[model samples]
Target: MEFRVLGPVGVWNRGAEVPLDGAKQRTVLAALLLSGGRALPDSRLCELLWGEHPPATYPAQIYNYVSRLRKYLGPDVDIRRQWSGYMIHPGDGRLDLAEFERLATLGREAQENHRYEEAADAFHAALALWRGPALMNVTEFLARAETHRLAEMRMAVLERRVETDLLLGRYAQLVPELTRLVGEYPLHEKLRCQLMTALFRTERQADALAVYHEGRRVLAEELGVEPGPTLAATFRAILTAEPARTGGPSVVASSWHAVRPAMLPPAIGDFTGRAAELSALAEVLTGDHACAAQVTGMAGIGKTALALFAAHRDRDRFPDGQLYADLGGNRGNAVEPQEVLGWFLRSLGNAEPSIPRGLDERVRLYRSHLAGRRMLVVLDDAADDAQVRPLLPGEAGCRVLVTSRVSLSDLPGAAVVEVGTLGTAEAVDLLAAVVGKRRVANEPAAARRIVRLCGWLSLGIRVAGSRLVARPHWSLAYFAERLADEQYRLDELRLGTLDVRARLDGSYLALASQSQLALRRLALLEVPHFASWATAAVLGVPRRTGDEVTENLVDARMLEVTGTDGGRRQRHRFHDLVRVFAREKADHVDRMAVAASRVLTTAN
Candidate 1:
């Protein structure tokens, strides 16, 4: 028989789990197991089980649970009622808590005698006994003291084991685990110092220093104090690249240099407008606290450009490095998170030979490298939450920026910034910036008209401006007249290599069958915006389903929320360019309106 309190309170007989019944029985067993072979009175057990709310029949209930446990344990375990209370004697049974204590004692002795390898092994064995948080499924009130004591002991043993590992010169191997540990125990100076030492030994001098700065920032922000002397000394040593050696091999260095990857694609030269968004991004990314911002919009709405522009403008702040990966979400067959981590690890100075092989291990190593560094990680064109989730740094010193056409609502704690079409004035400014201010200034009305025709979208405005740049002889009015025809507006909104219709097609093809049908039907309404009821009328579905499909389109950036109407009902509008694209996808407006009127009349 073996008793375990490391996880849920339970007993195992012959390597098979023995059923312990309800919470009361488990509580009784836990009280006796934690007693270390001492007797626990019924009164103490009652208090543990029910606190001050013990019923009049509590003693009977306790006896019933005890009797049941005895029958379950069989003849090997003895549950005897003493003069004071009940005593459980696991004469031939093993107790995991006792084993943990025994191993921890052995580890302590080995460490005192300088048997680092034995000490590390013993401590690791003791720590591994914990299946999860101690007595996790047990009642909080019943397990509070034991839980705290065991958790604190576990942490102490972990620190000692890490110290032993450090003594054994396992710096490179310890980086990933130490990184995770520091995140878990951010306030522990010992762990922080150990991590700094490990980084320094691995020749990541800049990364080691960055860890120190991050620790100082975390301490000051979280606890309103500075790092203790030990951590401070480690930081100082790393700053000078002269780490103190305590009977370990000397650090071999000379060839390795900090990798500062300038991977951001060039920001658009005439990246006009988005002043408010720029300021907001600067404020969020520049803060000492780590954060993530998600930029979402339709295809060709400048989601990638906005992210790149912000990252480039704030490049100097992240002295550690800048990394960019196009997840290829728009192009389809998006890059996997593992692939991105591999590239990021290499960019962070990790050699190919040193990078972990497993996906999870790679993620850990990637985050470890970014632990203390102030870097900007921009994940562009992410497919969805899964692709972006694993790539997030989750470090205070680093800031993550993600761009996707799909809403990353699944990314917890991410500040969502929706990039919409440029305002009319901003759109005109972008045209002027691209086609030369002299031409735009000469025909300001024509420029405004041209932007309106292009639906005030940055890409649309840029494409229109590029076309005029190629034909300097043709005035803005000439292009505006060309785009004036609604039937041919999308076809005309194209310049060498820039095609609005192609971009719209990509977004359209990505939608589900129902949303596609809803969009096609709604596009034929010819209104600036319509309600879910109208969508239901066209799709021949319930209003509720219509609302769901409408929101999906919005999430896919196919529709924009204009505002609520007079009756306080949501009225969704389409981007002018999007309307044209939808019409091109489904061109039966007259028939759609006739069917819509009949559906509306029948519903009324």
Candidate 2:
């Protein structure tokens, strides 16, 4: 027997549709389904079904309905009569509404913990169950009200799903759907806000802003009210081009001339693959809410490249200005929070002398300056929590984009996005994107070898691509040959000027000695995924100490806590580049020792 309530309430028993005798009976069944096995009072049901009007034999009528439903439901169904009212046990029957709620709740929980991919899956599952309006056959006023409630819930779930996708950076893919949704729900302020955000992320700043204006006009003409604070703030963001907070400069500015698209440095080529990654990013930005997305990976995995691609795509969204800063958290001269704030204030046109000296004072002034303007700030290579915090705008009108090898969980309400290696196909495309397609096609096998040798690191691919671009006479086969020599592969890949090693070194130098050692030890594990206990075993330290070390690594972007599954198992993994670095740092003997120990400890 299948009882579906996600659309019209229906029961399929023994291959036939069980006729629900009257509107009241259907209403009773729906009410029971909504409550999900919980008892609802007769009075409440009466109020819901008949409102102020009650039939002369209301009690008798309800009893008769329950009796008839029981006959159809058969022995498997449990219809219990309680003092308050009644309860229906759906048993093993498929109830769409019940499943929908369950999946929605699960998705929400996953999102809260930063498991975006999983959350998207859960939400999609929930949404798929909805065939159409809930209880479409029923005409009772109470049924109509319930139907409306379910419809609203469906929208909310869809919005959440979109939000998860955006956080994953799936902006481009979501644009079409969001456009339609925005039109369908023209008066819904929240939906409008999401549409604007998605449009902005896709580099359609003008369109995003247009959506806000259209929403304002619709609201005024129909409801006689201005846009609410959320919508208003988003509109202001559109006007100023506030960067969504990923953490860097709220805007990027160039002196001497206006910055044009052509002026930006070309991202590393041979960018073989990251379609999934890019799609995930678009999804979060277009999803139905503002999110703080964190892009983290090991040094030289192209975290910056991916972030830059996303920024460029959405650059038009932040018209107030685009800000970029290297926080120096990973290596080199760490850019202090105060220093970044000062630079940001100056970029906003605050003169050096006018920029506040005190940290708190500067933060206040910075936020005050950005109060009503929409700006986009990119804090690249963030060093630590303190370095990024003061730079965040206080108003909701701005967007910040932050990129780090470390995880910045300390940054409250920020969404964390982890970047991994490019897939084989993306690697090939990236190479093609950078080096001419003709050259790659001429030596497809050699090109594949180069990609694998580069470990599909964006930085490595770019360096390899740059080499190919600069040396026109060199064949792809030659580059592959050089990478094949393990002893000098890293050195060979290290072009004197643009070196991925140097970039990674900067972040490594910033770490404390113990943390660095812990990172090295982590390289010993063969398993791609791990937990605190597994990490602890590798470090030869207590679980708490291991946790602290792992946390430090996470902050530094050397590792990411993917999520907890089942019970106590908290999954963690290093970005492919980081893993490569760890392996490079470990000699064969040390690596073997660590791996063996981890295995034994985990087994016990």
Query: Could you say which candidate leads in TM-score?
Result: 1
Any runs in candidate 1 off by more than 4 Å, and if so which?
Answer: 1-256, 351-354, 566-568, 587-604
Q: Write the per-residue lDDT of candidate 1 for residues 77-174, one digit (tens) a residue.
A: 89988533688888889989878767876886787688988998998899899888888666655775356546655766677677778878999898
TM-score of each: 0.61, 0.51
**Cα distance off (Å), candidate 2, residue 219:** 39
Report lDDT per candidate: 0.77, 0.70
Model 2 weakest lDDT span, ten residues long: 248-257
Error of 2 at 201 (Å): 40
lDDT of 2 by residue, 309-343 (tens): 87677667656666778776666778778887877
Deviation (Å) of 247 in candidate 2: 44
